[model samples]
Target: MLLATSNHLGHDIRSEKYNVRGTKYRTKHFLEFCIFLFFIYEIEDNLIQNTR
Candidate 1:
């Protein structure tokens, strides 16, 4: 199962960076990506514990 949903966020960032009408503020992507990786790690940990 896919965990990170960065595709839409990535598109938004690109659009904002390129388009004139969108906001150009940046910083959340890295934060969100880290959080997502954390969740994936937690899930994997739980699965490993359950299998033991």
Candidate 2:
């Protein structure tokens, strides 16, 4: 999850540096990252519950 977030942020930074209009792209990437994080959290929660 951290890697995914880092990759998205890196892409956004690269887009900004290249003078590409990045607002939309960044927003999309951020939303994707949030979704991925939520998925990871759910998986972790399930694992913890199963362990107990």
Candidate 3:
């Protein structure tokens, strides 16, 4: 599921950020977080359609 995948990605991002603490890593994680947000939006849309 998207939620599970996002949770896994979040765990990886947190662990990697702590392990490295580099600007490049921070930017990469930021971008990934943006993509995760987009996916959340998509999931919401799907749920709305299902309810309708």
Candidate 4:
């Protein structure tokens, strides 16, 4: 996948493939995307505790 920065804040990120499921994934930075993988699962682990 080619990651291109569309702006200075790295907010406008896009992938090469366009899924037809109507899911538009976006990210603020490439680094965030790297950590996002784990974050997807963290909701069940720490999200409940961190919500308070």
Give the winner by lDDT.
Answer: 3
After superposition, candidate 2 runs with Cα above 4 Å error? 1-20
What is the per-residue lDDT of model 1 for residues 1-52, given as tens digits with 9 covering 90 to 100?
Answer: 1335587778878887677433232346667878999999999999999999
CA lDDT, candidate 4, residue 14: 28
* Candidate 2 per-residue lDDT over residues 1-52, each given as its tens digit: 9999999999989978766656767888999999999999999999999999
| Tens-digit lDDT track of model 4 for 7-48 | 523542323234422344343455678788778778767877
* Candidate 3 C-alpha error for residue 4, in Å: 52
Tens-digit lDDT string for candidate 3 (1-52): 9999999999999988887768778899999999999999999999999999
TM-score-wise, the better of 1 and 4 is 1
Best by TM-score: 2
lDDT comparison, 3 vs 4, better candidate: 3
Q: What's the TM-score of each model vs. the native?
A: 0.51, 0.60, 0.55, 0.22
Cα deviation of 16, candidate 3, in Å: 20
Q: Which residue pairs in model 4 clash with each other? A: none
The Cα local distance difference test for each model comes to 0.75, 0.91, 0.94, 0.54
Write down the worst ten-residue block by lDDT for model 4.
12-21
Clashing pairs in 1: none
